[model samples]
Target: MQRRRFKETSSLEERLDQEAMRLREHKLLPPGWLREQAFRKARQMNIAAHINEWLASPGLRAPI
Candidate 1:
């Protein structure tokens, strides 16, 4: 038995399918999962507005 290799151009559908297949083969964790849960817990404590304000203030400062 011999292995065969072929090179062929991919159609748009084929490219999309290949991309999906590659992603499926990878182990991807949800982004900031721990931070997301922490945020939810903090919101239950009615601190979400403070958190948003804290996050916004520094970024809002004008450049010197």
Candidate 2:
């Protein structure tokens, strides 16, 4: 096996810019309603987790 190393360390801003460029090179991302749906799904999952946690604690039970 061989080891590899970066020519030099990169700053946080430079790393983020590089990531954005790489993503753009990959065709295009979902847009409009599709993008909205993706975000909504993520939010729904987060809310579900919070609700489940609350339900698990009798003192924090949500009103039926």
Candidate 3:
């Protein structure tokens, strides 16, 4: 089996922000459970991006 890979044009933070903003523009975002789930996913994505950045910091990279 093979998986397809492609280059991403935007940063993770940008993509997450765009998703949140798109949801905010929808009226259903406030009262719809489905949109709520999407919002939660966006938030989780942001948290993961931050964690990845933290782990990739120069301070964390020891001379091993």
Q: What is the C-alpha RMSD of each candidate to the true structure, in Å?
A: 17.1, 12.6, 2.9
TM-scores, all models, native as reference: 0.29, 0.44, 0.59
Please list the residue runs of candidate 1 whose C-alpha ends up more than 4 Å from where it truly belongs after superposition: 1-8, 28-64
Clashing residue pairs in candidate 2 (N, C-alpha, C atoms within 3 angstroms) = none
Error of 2 at 63 (Å): 17
Worst 10 residues of 2 by lDDT: 20-29
Residue 32, model 1: Cα distance from true site in angstroms: 6.8
CA shift at 22, candidate 2, in angstroms?
19
Q: Which parts of model 2 have CA positions greater than 4 angstroms off?
A: 1-30, 58-64
- Candidate 1 lDDT tens digits, 1-64: 9999887686444554455445443335365665565445544434444454566777877899
The parts of candidate 3 lying over 4 Å away from their true place are 1-5, 23-30
TM-score-wise, the better of 1 and 3 is 3
Which 10-residue window of candidate 1 scores lowest in summed lDDT? 20-29
In terms of lDDT, model 3 sits at 0.73
Quality of model 1 by C-alpha lDDT: 0.53
Q: For candidate 2, give the lDDT of residue 38.
A: 53
